[model samples]
Target: MVTAVTDHTDHADHPGDDEGREGSGHARVEDDFVTDRKDVRKKDFDMKDFIKRDTGKKDAGKKDAGKVGVRSESRMFGLVRVEIDDYPEKPASGDDTDGTDGIGNKGRADGAAGADAADAADSGVSWDDGLIARRVSATAEGQARPVKEAVVDSRPPVVTPLAYDGSLRSRLDALRELVGLSRTRLDSRTLAEAGQVLDEATARRRLSGQHTVVAIAGATGSGKSQLFNALAGVAISETGVRRPTTAAPIACSWSDGAASLIDRLGIPGRLRRRPLQSAEAEAQLRGLVLVDLPDHDSAAVQHREQVDRILALVDAVIWVVDPEKYADAVLHERYLRPMAGHAEVTFVVLNQIDRLPGEAADQVLDDLRRLLDEDGIALGEYGEPGATVLSLSALTGDGVPELREVLGHFVAERGAAVRRISADVDAAAARLWPVYANRRQAGLTEEARDEFADRLADAVGATAAGEAAERAWRRNANRACGTPWLRLWRWYQDRREPPTGRLSVRTHADEEATARQRVEQAVRTVAEQAAGGLPTPWAQAVREAAVRGSQGLCEALDELAVRAGAPVGRPPRPGWWPVAVLAQAAMTILQAIGGLWLLGQVVGFMSPNLGVPVLLMVIGIVGGPGVDWACRLAARGPARRYGLEAERRLREAASGCGRARVLDPLASELLRYREVREQYLRVTGVGV
Candidate 1:
């Protein structure tokens, strides 16, 4: 039996909420529940007439129960729910009482019923029929199958790994930027090594991307040339025991495409040879450029140098050793230990293991493993990726196929070139980390800058200039507003030395020398403050920048101080000064008139009574002194303001000079150091 339910929601409660009835609104609710309330149509499906029932394996005397299956489908109209329950049992006879097969038309016989069942399986409701058929089939078999439910996944997608060439190119770009930014601040030799690494990486990438260059290197009498010949399947490199047989490097190519790569290794064209043609063996080793390098411990200096040069350029290295010299100190200490980080591209081959007897070969291999572990080389055992350590006798061909199979897979991966370049970049950046990276984020503080400016101001005598300005104002005020006889007496005294001459900014030889010393000390103090907690190279750069900037600093300060403090012509007089001068003139004239009248009285040329003249003389004497004192008192406030303004201008000029000469250059050097450090971090992939 099939049951169908269609839900019809009423919209009468929310009449104004028509937003849910639009196209965009319907899309918004698609992820949610089906809430459409208009134009919904319902139809029911009779699943019994179309689905097949299995009748072979029913239990004895047990009531049959229909399988339960629920399906919900979403449409534009509304949600439709379907369920199956209480399936009818099959009849005992082959032909039904109604003369029809359960899955076809009403009156069809066996052959026609088969055709009709095929037609019904192809109908529009086939998905429903298929699901019901599986349920009934499970029921007939008397098995309880767990119902499958939909699972909602909420996890975000995984981030893709970076591509090899892209990431390497980005690191190279960052390293270039780091070198450019660290020009005058870092060690020249370290930067040169970094540049060389970048150059080598670029040149390697320009060659064949399909090929892998594997170099076989070992000490004298290690049979590396024999292993090289075994892998090449030809006697390409001569192998005899004359202490050091292979005196130079030789290249063997499995394919002809590695000419450019071999040329880059500085190998002559005559030493390059193709392996013997065995199609199956050669096809597995295609695109392989195997290099036979000279003995690393040869008595000849050029042979050792040749080994070093070729080892530096190869994409991968196979260190071949005999059973006796597998733990040689020169090989372990100079090559294996130093290239420990390049373990992924390294292979340690214990050659001539056929020479050992019984379990002695196994014991020698175990001891070699111990020595490799001591040299910090990780072994690629138990499916972990590291250096590949194996035993083989190149002369007897005992384990050469295993080495050949490993090399075949290694060459086919075509990742050795990229890995070697990445390891090289990592090693170079690690070496430069001490010069580029520091724990503290050092900078110049505002207090230090302010104190530096204050020191410069003091060195130039700004405070003394301000005091002298105030005193000059008071003296000029006295000259303009004092009584005429007092003024004449002051002018006679001032004629010996002018006040303008005293206001000139003149430094004697000793004072100038002292000012220079003070400027140097202030510059040094600020440089030290800025350089604190920085790396040695950067700290030295900061100090050098400050010293270079302070070359003519003392002279600049002297010029600015003279310009700021020099008095222009005479001091400016206020409008009130003229009024005070007139008052003083009136008082002086009164004194003169009174003295003339008293003189007339004494000479008997005028009236004898002189009371008015005596009164006039007394008023003039008291009034003149009182007016002079009043003018002097009024000049104090403006004189103070003028002095402060002079001091302010001088202070500003001195501070500005100091900032330009010392502070700005130091800040720029610090900024350069910061930029270079950031680039270094990018190259190293630190904090990525």
Candidate 2:
């Protein structure tokens, strides 16, 4: 029982009608009369009619679209009830709503019509540029009562930012550090090459990255000059029958802002040129700087040298070969073979293909590929990344477009400079691999250090000094507590021998000389053990460190020996020594009295008792000996403890001196080698 209706208003009355409906694409819903739901009519306005009606009368409203204010009214009268949910446009100043509809909604026709035009003009947004509101909803009158949710359509596209790449810079920095650490330990020649790579990479990065330097090089009479002129679209480089027409390099820039890059190649300003004035046609080659190098096999030595120098500086190279000299041994062996690692930035062109008939060109190309393969250059075909090979004739202009297209793509990528520098780093690292990581690291071992300390202690005579101290202590104890007659007898017996009152710990000159020899030998032995299994250069470095540290070590050891072996005096006496001395004295007196009585009795000067004399003699004999024996037994333990303490002091002093002089320096050198090797591994990306 539902029906639909469409209303059309005259466009001539509203001068700003086009502006009101410019980017708001939905048609206006208006004029609803409430009635019973069974008899309701719902209708959707046709968009084609709305657009056609607007376009047909657009000229009448165009003049005043932004200037004049007009009214647009929509009215509906029916039994069906409809609700209009309109998002009114932002109104201009001094406009208000004046009318209300059946759904209790206020309507303002004049303000609504002029609001879009005023807001668009003020915000500088073109509604015709498709600025549509997000919410456009409507409700239809039907028994089912369908509802549409407010949603947005045709939002602007999102753009993602590119991530920065720092892998190349990081690797180059690591290589530079390794080179710095290896200056004294590694060969000068190998270090110089690594230094050159670092210098080149730094200088190339300082220039504009947008420009790529590509050189055209070949042997004499290869028509490389002709190819260069053809690619440049001008005859700037001299070409003739001369032996070496292009003695120096000539630079051709496709676009501007390449003067600094060309100067970095060492080309003079007079030899620089712009190929074409109009840049839009050669937009793909905007950053290409082409150079024509001298003949590599020229008879003139300087020309060949110039070619070699320029080739090393350029980012990429194109080797043009004629069919006659395509497989020259000098080109393959001297240049191409050595540069096999740089295949990603190389191009091989078979020039003068016009001379070869139909299938001959393809056959020669296949043969060139085979030669390059033998030279260890990968072919950039079948979707592999390698050197690009193609056939072209500079004279006939055959296959020039394909070469130009390939060159343009290569130039646009803007990665030739980075790739070439990275290849150079790889080559340098490969050359230095043997010096950095040929064998397992060897370090100073604990057993070697202990043996070194023991040797030094022996050289200083610590053991002999300890034994002398022990004997000195025991001899002093016997002298302090022995019986008076026995002491006199012992002193008289030692009159012919040297004095034993103090220990003789002083070392002789010959012994000192022998100790010096032992010190040197110990240092050498420890250094060898620490540097065992190391490379020759590192071993030499470790030995040098030990030698440098051992300069005044022998003198230092002599001084330490003197301090540790100082003369030892008598040990402190026990309190029982006095009592023992008094007992010995009393025993001597008793023995003297007994001897006198016996002499008197034997000589008949006085009457004597034999029992008393005999008993006195026996008591004196056993008591003095027993007291001396007890004191000697007590002195043994203290003497041994004192000797051990002296030994420990001397041993520790010798060990400390050896550690400071030899072992520490050797260990530092080994640590330095390990640090440099670690940086080399980082440069090569091993284990990381």
Candidate 3:
């Protein structure tokens, strides 16, 4: 904008750049020099006229001057006009203008000065009112002015786009969630058609948010292709007396943005039409992509297949029917009746209605609607939109406008694709509900879990491990804490057979096989119990999950068995064993010395030591035996306690080993199924 300022003297530079000013939506500062210039020029041109008209009438001239001042003041100070001399009050000596007029040359200069002052005052009057002014004085000052651009300082407000409908977004979100369900549990193959529908909806919307795909479906000789051409207002599809003339799929859109959608439907480029510009009468149908599919009852298998393929992908189906074939079983029984959930996007057009009388046409429509209702179709009325029933003749273009309007309303709402996908998802989810309903609501019982753990424990020879720990503990305690006199006998027994090698017992290969079989049996039992009240398919699924979970468990159990059967570490003994051994040693030495002396005396080779020797021998022998008895008695309690503790530890360890190998996997499978079920419920909007 300021660049223009450089070209024109009046257009001066402003605060913002040209581009910024244009896009800012802001007010620009402007100079109102034109209005002031116009007022001044008018005053100067009328100066002579005013003097001639009121010659010699100085009072009249004075009145005229006063009025001019009032008018000019109004112009300067807004609507409120006031009266006063804008010129420095003309000289009291009557020399205010030149002699040729009413005052001298000095007064004329004074008038010019006063005019400049008035113009300045007028500019600020928008902020504050002017006191007084005169018009004649304004003309003396040439108002060399600039254009005043209004000053705009506020920023634009934030705006949110309303491109996609809220309901459409929510419905698509729901369908997307439904598609995320587990394949193994949901029969993905069975839902393949529904899955294709979901993908087509999202892909089509991504490419073109506007176009509503309306597929023309009917048996041969129904004039479906002609109806499609009539709706398009163009002879796009090859329509004639020939049967199944529309070989591939003939597609025509009313507006742009449907190229990718057409490609996704696998329509060949040759058969596909570039969208025609929207017309005023048919503007509402601008977003509609009408597809003329091959006849459903075509003799050629490929034609029927093409029809089926396009039918599954399109947003809506317009079933074109002749009066004679309107009640055809193949068309309604196989397709319409099975698609009850899709009533919102289904259409039944009784074509050739023009061939019938008014009463006959009405009767045919009523009968057709009745058949549709019997097929579980919810026919849309004038106000309520659902499955619609229309009667028309594509050959004569009768009822085409009404059909166009209907398509327009659907395309305008932009919900046909979403509604179509939502129904598909609902149908698929309904089919998969039974497998997950009960499991989603409740999990496997705690008793079942405990029973499973116990089964695993028994499978891995938990008893053998416990008994091994106990016997090992006892052997260790007795060896470390029993009497020194019995130590020699215990060493001899260990040397003889190694104390039965506690925990490391021999096992037959057949016993291992039997244990493994018992483990598998236990898994089966737990699975059966968990699946008790479920329906057959779900029960079978649970059983399969358990079997899959239990894989490699037998091998893992063998490893656990080897570990459980191994000997446990020895138990710690009391410190009193050492003191007892020392005391016993001393007593034995004393007894030996005393016995030697007594023998010498009895043999008559030494002094008679009867009193001391006999007493020492008796005390040493009796006390040593008594100490052994006391140590043995004390060892019994510690040994039993240590044994019991060892058994408990070993049993717990063995059970844990078996559990990780077998039970954990089984439980995880069940848990996964439950989590998926919960997710499924959430997608269904039944739970948080």
In order, the Cα lDDT scores of the candidates are: 0.71, 0.71, 0.61
Tens-place lDDT per residue, model 3, 1-688, is 2211111110011111222223333333433221232454455444335323334454544564322211221122111111121222121233333312111001222344334343333333221111111111111344333333333222332221223355545544655555564565556675575467567656655655566788999888898877876775544566767765767777776654466677778875435553322245346776677888888888989988888788787888989999999999998888898887898998889998878975999998899988988987887786665698888899888887888787778789887876776677666667656665673344467787677767776767666665655566556545554445677886787689853543444445666778778878888987787677654555677788778767887776667556645444445667776876677777787789889989999899898869999889888888777766676777767666655564455456546754664456556656666666666565465664
Q: For candidate 1, lDDT tens digit of each residue in 344-413?
A: 8999998898889999988998998899899888888877878998999998999999999999999998
Model 2 Cα displacement at 210 (Å)? 1.1
Q: List TM-score per model, in order.
A: 0.65, 0.65, 0.57
Total clashing pairs for each candidate: 0, 4, 15
Instruction: Report the C-alpha lDDT of model 2 over 529-636, residue by residue, as the tens digit.
Output: 887878778889999999998899988887887787635456666677787778877887788888888888999997978988877877787777877888789888
TM-score winner between 2 and 3, please give it: 2
Off by over 4 Å in 3: 1-195, 223-226, 229-280, 352-367, 382-385, 392-402, 427-449, 471-510, 523-570, 575-637, 663-688
Between the candidate structures 1 and 3, which one is better when assessed by TM-score? Answer: 1
Model 3, position 555: C-alpha lDDT score: 76
Q: Quote the lDDT for 176 in model 2.
A: 88
Please give the RMSD to the true structure for each candidate, in Å.
25.9, 20.4, 23.5
